[model samples]
Target: MLKKVISKTIQLPDNRVITIETGKLATQANGSVLIRMGNTMLLAAVVAKEAPEEGGFSFLPLSVDYQEKFAASGKIPGGFLKREGRLGDHEVLIARLVDRAIRPLFPKRFNSEIQINISLISADETILPDALAALAASSALSVSSIPFNGPISEVRVARVNGTFLINPSPSLLEQADINLIVAASDSSILMVEGAMSEVGEADMIAAIRYAHDAIKLQCQVQKELMEAVGVEKTIGTTHHASAIVCYPIALREAIYADLYAVAKQHIPSKALRKEAFMAVSNRYREQLAKDQNGQEVTTTQQKEWLDELENQAIRALILNENVRLDGRLLDQIRPIESEIDYLPSAHGSALFTRGETQSLTTVTLGSKFDEQIIDRAMEDGYNRFMLHYNFPGFSTGEVKPNRGPSRREIGHGNLAMRALKAVLPPDKENLYTIRVVSDILESNGSSSMATVCAGSLALMDAGILVKAAVSGIAMGMITDPTTGRFAVLSDILGDEDRIGDMDFKVTGTYQGITACQMDMKVAGISYAMLEKALHQAKEGRLHILEKMAETIAAPRLDSKPHAPKIVTIEVEKEMIGAIIGPGGKVIQEIQKETFTNIDIAEQGYKGIVTIFAGNQEMLEKAVSRIKTITARPVMGEIYKGKVKSVLNYGAFVEFMPGKDGFLHVSEVRLERIENLEDVLEVGEELQVKLIGIEPKTGKYRLSRKVLLAPDVVAAGG
Candidate 1:
């Protein structure tokens, strides 16, 4: 039987088109779609369990995995395994992007385990596949029988030379000052995440709006393709429960007043506030049991009602009374305190605390050899700057086991890295490989933002010449659905984030936003609210930066005493071999003598040499040796020379590091010398002057009698 292949096309700005085809591959999957543009193709296959996991999950069990096949780019995987083992950070980030966009579109009561796997089967150098992952995943859902409220798609918007390009080529993306990946349904934006070069609030919103326009077109294409495939939304076929779980209205009425009172208490301690709320909830549970006259109340039922009550009370208090759980007004930030050099032995360290969240961050500098090798399917490069975020369970006052970095940690660290990477000095000026690690010692909310603040401070303290200090703030929103009254909270707490409608984080210098990420739990967020959040987040960020400035305003004059010092020099391309000598012998000797590390790369007509040493003295020694090796031999220039060999006719002396010259027997002394070894033994050091070069051999000539006194010459004659 012939397969029924269906495809749809989306025409974008600049006449670029993306095609989505179904029924061609992965036929065993519940739904599968292949999305392609400019020779780049991503195959997204989604599978959903008909029933929930054994116990029935309280939350949506959705997982998204994005992988890139080395065969996609016609390259072999690195490492001894010679195959992809685990998902790299980059792949995890892309999976997260897709997951965030489609997660909210699923029904709240549907707890089925859904897995979306997107693979890059074909790679295009100019066109990146990350921006297409979400589109493919959503398209797969659209064609499936799964109950989804989405035909959403994502697009990349980049502003280069004042023009906004949709899903631009990689080269264009590099020159973009405003880069954003926006996910949206046909009507509303769902997710926004990307980095910028200090772009303003208005421009950021405009970019999102611009991206949504393209997304609308792509979403429409998915809808058309789904219709063409004739897949009906059969909710009952899958274990999708459409019923809205309703709690006892009487229970809510009885507990809401007390919960609101507890919320209004302005309890500063997280633990205390939690206890107070729990007391009211438990009291209500007892009252309900008494009202029912011994009706059994399961913990799940009690929790469900209590959660509903707390959500109502906190949101009501904020909307009606204009106060938060901690009694701060809307748009108000929590207290901030920061310190630098907190760890005595670290190259650089800082402790940044905002309210209950704290990040103890440290900076480590290393040589080029320390750079992280990125061997991916589409690209092979080195990451000189890395930020690792560690969130131990103790940070949140829990007893969780340490199981390496989770997806959340990697995502947080990547955001912080992007936030500060824009402010780093050029590679030529800063040669050391930099790694910033953030350990969350205490966390209530926005620990990732604290990492940004602390990482900036630590980088500066480590004598890294950062262009500007960066800070971050997590903004939240609470909306009254009945009245459409919304409040944008700055520097939100853990409770606010849990109950809030939006978690929007912005990071940047004082000027504008450098990086931003927004995830909405609500159906959608208005652009006006987004703009308000951006500006509010900016105010909070600026305030936090003020606290940071009080600790360390700028980079130190130099790195710490124990930190390695790096110096770079350039030489003629032809001299690169001479510096390395026969199989790196010369470079190795120089390093051994000066206690330094050296690396050289040939670029264009020059060779770049980087030297890493323990101190200024050792650095100077290595630099001098490299200079001598690369320096050109000049006539009439005197130099300290080492005799490499003593022959009967002449002594072969190294006038410069790699340049050898012949010193005639007569040139060694004012009088005739029968044996050159008598005056100049092998490995002897002497002073000589470069005289001339042999016409055909390009050999150098050296002389020693040119500086002799006239009286001494007359006496010898």
Candidate 2:
């Protein structure tokens, strides 16, 4: 017998319907929901394998998979390797988004092995899979017995020409100056990702509000689905609320005042700030310990009090004095200094520093064959241009083992890549493979934005014809409605990002936006605020661009000497066998002789060979060898030949055709010769001319001498 389930569906204004089917699939799982919007559909299933072990709540192992099958888009897998194998960048990012949104929803002790799978059955391209995946995962966990707090919803808010567009189409997104994906749990924001030309705090807040309101209907559907078929939620773990202890408010106020006074005396450095705070915390702890009441305080309680004091001091410093810990104004951006051509051997290189954050971005150009081939469960394609961000431990004054690129690096690189994608030349006849590597030498806040600035300069230094120079800025916001106050900060600092409500990063060209990412710690923002932020961001971005242009106006026309030289050749189908010989022998010989890298297409008609050397001379030598091996010999050509044999009337001359031709004694020289050996010798090269062909005899007639003076002939005789 089939189990009956409750499901709800709502039609969006864009003619797309979102459906939440519950208790229909994956019944054993904690929560399951299948969401279908337009032609795109996703089935999200959440299951908690086990609860946390004793005293082991270090981290959450939440595995999320956003899989895409070739069949979903009516396409077959390409390449000799016929299967999708790895998780693509897109898949990893979607998984990260879902994990970030749902991980915080669970209680602290609920360390369950949460596994959420989002399978894309169809893809319409207009509906982004990442936001939908986050929504489905949140709803699925809510209706499950996995002890989740409740349902959550996500929406993509884009601003185009000062208008807020919720869940805009992919094409419309191309024109948007700011794009933000916000995930909320009704009252508070859980996750946010955005990019802009250089949006300010106000516009970013507006986008958050637009997305929050736009997702209301979807949230309602999730609630209805839970009512219809959700399993009974498990009771949350019980814990006692911390008891409030009275400390003299005047004493607390005095302690904060003294702390700020001491903070002002110290220089603004991360170490300085840490030491100052530690000293104040210790002084307060000592004072509390000596109280006559002898009220005992746990270390945890003392630490919490210290944290609250620190937060208050920092907030007060920013709000009342309008001065950051670093002594910068509320809206003053950090100092930026950029330089291009920093590396001698790089095709393009730039060093970008904003405040203490620094990044060295380098660009490399190669042939189309150098493009990265992606084989993933979600998507399969080739990317000619790639951006890689590297953050070493030393960049943050930390000690950690070095390994391959981390998830954070990948995500940041992808964000930069997306922001610059709009300005890249189309992948048509221009088939150069471009790769950019951004190394974060120092980081305080918004290193990714520094990467963007440095990357644009590096591309120009490498001679890339970008549409326009691009720059990025991180905007921060602090809003206290109780005081009827709000402050929008430009180029936020690390502490500002930590205590502030939002980290809105906007990157774009001078013409418009190219990429944007926004994340908020508070509830959400309004549309009006987002618009203002975008406008401010554009101004900030343009200022940064001006500074960058002073160092390098455009990409360099010449590449680095160390880079390889690519030479392409097209041969006939039949000649491919000759080039390859037996088991690639001929090609291997060419590689060995020329010291060149040869990449042959599987189709055998086209080949791209890369020659790497110190200069063009070596490259030319390699090209010459390949041309000779593949050259077609021509008939009736005058060539230097060696005399192989001598006859009574003529001599046989061996030419490059691997055949011998006759040189008549009468035509051997202008003067008559008694023997062929007198005028010519074996193993000697002699100039021979093709006279005519004796068709009846099928022999070639060649001559060394056609006419001579009679007197010279008589003298020789």
Best by TM-score: 1
lDDT by residue (394-469, candidate 1, tens digit) is 9988999988899999999999999999999999889989999999999999999999999999999999999899
Instruction: For each candidate, give its TM-score against the true structure.
Output: 0.95, 0.76
How good is model 1 by TM-score?
0.95
Give the runs in model 2 whose Cα sits over 4 Å from its true position: 10-18, 36-41, 47-88, 100-128, 145-152, 155-214, 230-234, 237-246, 259-267, 288-295, 364-370, 426-432, 481-484, 567-590, 600-615, 623-717
Q: Report the CA-based lDDT of candidate 1 relative to the real structure.
A: 0.89
Q: Pick the candidate with the highest lDDT.
A: 1
lDDT (C-alpha, whole model) for all candidates: 0.89, 0.73
